[model samples]
Target chain A: MATLEIRDLHVSVDAENGPREILKGVDLTVKQGETHAIMGPNGSGKSTLAYSLAGHPKYTVTGGSVLLDGEDVLEMSVDERAKAGVFLAMQYPVEVPGVSVSNFLRTAATAVRGEAPKLRLWVKEVKEAMAALQMDPAFAERNVNEGFSGGEKKRHEILQLELLKPKIAILDETDSGLDVDALRIVSEGINRVRSTGEVGTLLVTHYTRILRYIQPDYVHVFAGGRIVESGGAELADKLENEGYEAYVKGGASE
Target chain B: MAEQNTTGSTTAGSIEVGTAGAGAQLAGPGTGRTTVHQPIDARVAVKPSFDVNDFPVPTGREEDWRFTPLHRLGGLHDGTAAAGERGEDKVGFTLPDGVTAETVGRDDARLGKAGTPVDRVAAQAFSGFEQALVVTVPKDAVLTEPVRIDVRGEGGVRFAHVVIDVKPFAEAVVVLNHEGTGTRAANVELLVGDGAKLTFVSVQDWDRDAVHAAQHSALVGRDASYKSVVVTFGGDLVRLHPRVSYAGPGGEAELFGLYFADAGQHLEHRLVIDHDTPHCRSNVAYKGALQGQDAHAVWVGDVLIRAAAVGTDTYELNRNLVLTDGARVDSIPNLEIETGEIVGAGHASATGRFDDEQLFYLQARGIPADEARRLVVRGFFAELLQQIGVAEVQDQLMEKIDAELEAAV
Candidate 1:
């Protein structure tokens, strides 16, 4: 089982004005097969936590100690962190022209699995995964994210999640822009991966609607660059009945 | 007799496979532009001269020779260079029964009838050639095999002339492969007769020390179709000029070029397509990649549509991928339309380093940065490689490109 420990994490971004701190002092811990929901209003540092954890170059780890099973994650490069079993299903998947989806997936599989997947078997596996995600088989031949719709991008991210099989997956707004049918298909893909019991799911989103599809074990109310309150699934229900107002008022959080 | 050269042993697929639309995404001429850059200069005066003395040696100041290094020309422009001790040029042909090759004197009526020497070196070639090789395809004859001519140059300076004449209603493909070059200047003419189709491939894979300059001209007959593929690799300095003019209406021309330049190599191609006839069509696309310090690739495309050429359609695009820090590329595409009545006319030119986001997206998936880089380059050339109709040539080009990537990327 893998364990990720983020202690007092502080992050900043190189904005046009200067280095602006986004994550002041945040702490969270996630273990294998557990679902952690980080919910917050806009500009509350929720996506910042996701990107910083995944080692995005734009986000700087000013002061933090992130350990993945006692190994230092902060010291690793973005790709090294991925090799160390960290996956980030980005909110905006970058478009790579001339690189077909099938080729990219196969290359990533070869790099991560340490060898090329048997062509016959890999084709079947990818076809099945794409079917589960409701992605058209023709999509495999198109360039990655080139001219793709918003919902298609999200579905592709989930497709990678099902194939890469990382120890920890930080899904940044995977539910955004997805219609109800697409959301159901994407949620099913995440649930299938979660059913494997080898991945730690950190679902970062603004709404509790996705939490209903993929039930979260723990809910953390994130605000002011910190996880101010944490509770069981009841906290998400509370946030749903009310809103971030009770927590943002400064009493329910501390 | 077709004397085969030892350097011609490399199979058509062994050296380079290019033609890909990897640069299509980067082909835009940038935002909100109304005025075109430059017009095709018909008055530049590269007309073929019968006498070598009629053309003066260029000092690199002429419009056509501005990009060329006159010193690297090995005196082919002046008449100081001499032929090597190597006896003759080689030919590796798969000519069928319907095709014929004849070594004729310069006085032959067909010689210089299709094209004229545009520059001093071309005129020098026209004047100094001992004999011209004229290959002909019979009327209504569709050859199944490509007529292959391999010219192996020995480091000395040699002037030559060649012609491939396709008879009316005939179809053929001709490949002229140049290798083991010293200093060589030649003029090539293709006469595509009425209702005929011809595909011409000229591959210049000279030695690292060789210098080569050549002029290629084609005359398209009524309702005739012509296609040319120019692939350049190797050589210290190589410059090629390709010119096209239509003799009658309903003619079509397609020109595709691919080149890769390494350190200290200077490769330049200047193309002119004169739409002198009405209802003619032309398309030009050239892509190149440059690596190593001081490696340069230059491409200039000029298309002229005269007032008499109504209902003409033309488009040209050139793209360059600068793989390393020191490499450079200059691409200029010009179109001149004398008549307003035309189907479409436009051109695009782009030169840029590899896309960083493409690299990042690939690396994010665990493919190493270096491998990711190689894939990008391969994709950049993949579209052009697919355009090569011959499979063996494609394989050969793929292997050569792979070998280059192994050492560099």
Candidate 2:
């Protein structure tokens, strides 16, 4: 099975006093065709985990390593890791003022594929994909994320995920700012892509509303930079009902 | 020093005077004195109605030339002339149909007059053209290609003038390229008729020893539109002054510029947008990057919204990126609004280092530090390329920027 494995990953941001540890020995794994949801409260290093796995320089990996199908992922650059079938739907995608969505998508796709997409067919395909997500065709002409509404930026991230067609995607708080309608649209889009591509998915979120749309194969509770517990899809239901207090109090004794 | 008389008194109120002629006093460094030269009735062969003496000397005192590097003058302004060679003409850049370049000017008249406001001077060493190459777009003519003007320099100083006229309802895109070596000067005049549209792009990519001075003036008529883009790449010193006026109602003007200065190069751009008539719109955006020790760049943008120019919409911005520790960029955006009740009139100017977040993002993407920096610079310029509107021209510009980035690293 194609698997992404994170082994006792320790991370920190460099400080004059020494490295201030952020993620302390966090471990997790997911296989292809599987959907894993990581639920955690604020300041639990969830975003740090996503950024570190994506090779963001600010979140240094002080110990351990990340591997994709036995290949060391920490060794690859950000774009290289992305090209190697790993996509991170950023929590806040930076707005590139002068780059149009069409242009940015074309370049990213071209970079991932190592060749230019066919000109005539490229336009038609992009239009169709945008339509599938219920996004306006005019959005393609606008600068990437520039002047976009909060929901629009989130939808844009999903659009890139659909177009880039990565093997596995780690979505960081993709549902944070999305409204009910936008969240539904975003969930539907994710479902459509996963069903079609049969790719592995890792959903990082604090809410359970999105779980109703895309049922997770497994749910893991994260606290203190480590996975405290792992269970079936019912685990998400438990967290949604009981909250993280039970796990937090239980983990306090460990 | 012995007295040297360059030019003697020719007539009453008219003097055949050369500041370089013996007896003409030259200013030395640390001399706080500013000499005011007597205005001479200067005559240029082409466009005799326009007087070259009225042009001001770009001193640091003027708001328009404040950001310019006056220290680079280094005693080079004393009687320095441009090398003018009238050989076979060549054209670059794809041009639309019905537009062509022709040489114009008489033997006694040359384009390009230099100096500060008081000591206004014209390059006399360069030969004058009897007839300036004219690019005429007939009335109702709509062009599908972009016209290119290729100006080449070998050595010394060269002066050439080109006049472009767009008749009513005519549309065209014109590109002028200054390539080769030595010091060169040019004056470009664009006259657009009512309801006409014209886009002009000037690219200065000369050899290391080259010094370029260019003046662009446009007279836009009622309901007409004019757009100009200037790119400065290679040169020891390059200065461009672009003046545009909406002389009639419903006119629109856009001025866009991008420059990349390497080590030891100094580039300056001065832009003036005059909103003379009502319902006119003008937008100006200029961006630049300076790298290497002592590489300096400047951008001066002035937008004048006269009282008569009601309902005018004007916006301007200048952004510069300093790559090296010793690199510097100075920018000034000036907006003069006469009427309080106007539609949108403002400007912004900024000069700083590369954004750390952008750099980190690119580096995380697997691009090395150098390549990542190049990507950021390229992306910074991509803003202009997006507005170029022409595929071939845009591709060529991108390629040129890529070459510059490669060599710069």
DockQ of each: 0.40, 0.24
For all predictions, the C-alpha RMSD in Å is: 10.1, 10.7
What tens-digit string does per-residue lDDT give for candidate 1 at B314-345?
88778788988888787777666667778877
- Candidate by candidate, in order, the iRMS in Å equals 1.9, 3.2
User: What is the C-alpha lDDT profile of model 2 across B158-249, one tens digit per residue?
Assistant: 45667687889998888888788765555676877899999888889888767766667787889998988899998888878787766578
Candidate 2 accuracy as lDDT: 0.72
Least accurate stretch of 10 residues (summed lDDT) in model 1 chain B? B19-28
- In Å, residue B57's CA in model 1 sits off its true spot by 0.9
Error of 1 at B229 (Å): 2.5
Q: Distance from true position, residue B164, model 2, in Å?
A: 2.6
lDDT of 2 at B49: 19
| Regions of candidate 1 where Cα sits further than 4 Å from its true position | A15-18, A39-59, A147-151, A206-212, A219-254, B1-40, B43-46, B82-88, B96-101, B139-146, B168-171, B389-392
CAPRI grade of model 1: acceptable
TM-score of chain A of each: 0.96, 0.95
Candidate 1 per-residue lDDT over residues A1-254, each given as its tens digit: 79999999999999899998889898999999999999998788999998788776788899978999999999987777777888889888887765679988998888877789999999999999999888899999887898999989998988988888999989999999888888888899999999999999999999988987999999998988899889999999999989999666753332
